[model samples]
Target: MPKNSYKIPSSLNRSFLDHEVALSGGGFQAKPLPMKVLLFWSGSILTLFWVASSTFVAQAAWWLIALVVIWWLITTAFLGQYSKTKEMKFASVPALLAYVPAAARRVLTRTSTNPSSFYSVVGIDNISATGLIKYSDGTLGQGYLVVGSASILLFEEDRKAILNRVDSFWRKVDTSCEYTFVTTKEPQRVYHQIANLERRNLALEVRDPELKELMDEQYDILNDYVGKQFASIHQYLLLKGDNLESLRRAHSVLQAEVENSSLMIKGCTMLNGDEVTDMLTVLYKGKSS
Candidate 1:
């Protein structure tokens, strides 16, 4: 007999994960639901009551049950959309509570459904966007963003390595004197852009309004400071001229003040903001620039 070759069919792809959209606490980190007798029997009893509550003829009762089933399905499905995406925390507890709910409200403002493909958190300022990152086991990761899932797969996973790379670029400058800094203004333009982007594209819908705004605002503040700090450094360098050691000392003291002030603002962090402010005062007494 001639040689016969048989091919095995591949199974359909059905993973617990939704690769296209990976939000914080990815791939069903949802708490295991409490499936007690109350939930099970309550639903069952309600279902039975809903069916038997009707006193029409058998055929008519069947029609009524069908109608009820359809209605229940619609309501549950619609509500399910809202509950799909969970929120994350920011700096303050109040901010966390306020913004996340806002993000959800923003989502509800337009469509009844959540974003189809991706997940996003709109910061308070709106300019700083953290692209969704993933850890190896599919957790919400922190690092540089990878554009696509294919890119995520191809680039090779190095979460720790990339995070360290980000850490290396860190520059924390301290200032001894009070500075003219712009107070934070919410990014109205970016806010609208995000809304417009979500609206124009049916693929990605925003989930929480308040949370998005908080993120957007924080981004604006960070962005505004970034340039000012660099300029301040440049100005100091220019004014110092030949005295590099004095400049270094001034910078160090200023840095310490900053570290202190940061602690104050953060309250529980490494240094208090008041401590930073005090150091800055001392440095100011010693140097002019």
Candidate 2:
């Protein structure tokens, strides 16, 4: 394989669909405020100020009171409609009253769990793999591997060096291997067990106290793992056409290298391709039926 061998198809060149996947070198575009929204907010603030001023003066007119009442009703209606339409949860009266204390407690207990680095998938450029990864802690040790489009790109802080390495690595890869040994047995069993558990009405079931607690704990663990695996598969599925195939190959390579201490990079986790693929297949089958 040469640096110029792998070309990104035109179909896979669209912006990422996932909110979690950030694009490299792209900044957020500032959308202009609509004229109607601006006017509504301005009128709201003016009306609120008028109501306050009238209260202070102790000469509130009946007309002024009526206007304030109308404004309040309109504001409430607008907020209610917006929340309902957007499926947003508005704070209840009790929740609003308790918000201050809840917020304070949250601040006190907040843990610093942010990742030390951020990585984004940059598609191939007709030659080698390209992507951007930034380290918050600046201890950029070994390069990170991104698996997708049946290809793997080893990326480091140094752009030029990583590009060269990607080119060199691809040349040595035996692309002819059909990767015919995809093992879905374990993943299929997990998926079937998950489906069976989901269909069961566990909430109504009676069991021994100790057994119930242990079962609940195990259920939670399995559910969490399945969710993570599904998410990983969904992210890969976002890649269109041939890109998906490339990802499959890349994932296979990375899975083998996961336990290699010298090659494993910090702040990155390689997902199991076989599990993701099997889960996806099962999901598609369920959806179709």
Candidate 3:
């Protein structure tokens, strides 16, 4: 019998359970703390101790101490929830009683200067038809909607390789430019698209009973999924440049890398001006984009 020869696959192609992406120095860092939680807690405790140890504190009326305790409890609860919210303050007990009316008045008094509007918060000075977003600070940005998946079907090694490529691309890009990857959830809207397709192909479906039955089955599956209000996950890539030229360069580099590399990115769509606007509106206002 003739000798048999077999080829062994490369170790890089072997499936693994997990992988990690290496990052360049300064590519990412821990968030800075302006003030420590421990410091705040220490200060609060010291203040309370100073007050309670005072001569008048011991001689204070019972009702007065009870009122003070109630106030402290209320303020502590409020601070626990809204400490980071600067505009919201616990003015007094009277203010709490009038919260509803005060909230209505605040709504009436809201203005563009307060960052209540999408444009103000987003700082978009202009949006070009070609999908470049110009900011008030002279930065230019572009957004891309990414579609892809990672599941049991995709080996762990493959997932890591794709992530490594993505990390390399980020390190290769201009350091001054800002790049962000965001994942969000939205109500499923794909069923509507399927419904529209079914309507458009009604005549074809009528001519082929088999096709009609298949289409109906698929539509029902999607419709049932939608009826459950299961949120669909969306991924986005946002690139901001110091200037228009830098933005264009970054966009080209991204497109080339994504197309040439096996990053497992199945689809990427650049958002137009209107689409960008709608996206921001939906994000800020909780409305459909």
For each candidate, give its TM-score against the true structure. Answer: 0.20, 0.23, 0.50
Best by TM-score: 3
| Local distance difference test, candidate 1 | 0.35
Between prediction 1 and prediction 2, the one with superior TM-score is 2
Task: Report the Cα lDDT for candidate 3.
Answer: 0.65
Model 1: runs farther than 4 Å from truth? 1-45, 54-61, 80-257, 260-289
Model 1: per-residue Cα lDDT at residue 51:
58
Give one digit per residue, the lDDT tens place, for model 1 in 94-197. 75567676554453222466643113432111111322223223222111101111124433334334433323322333232222222222222244545554
Number of the predicted model whose lDDT against the real structure is largest: 3
Q: Between the candidate structures 2 and 3, which one is better when assessed by TM-score? A: 3
Q: What TM-score number comes out for model 2?
A: 0.23
Off by over 4 Å in 3: 1-119, 152-154, 191-230, 287-289
Compute the lDDT of residue 177 as modeled in candidate 2.
Answer: 27
Model 1: weakest 10-residue lDDT segment is 233-242
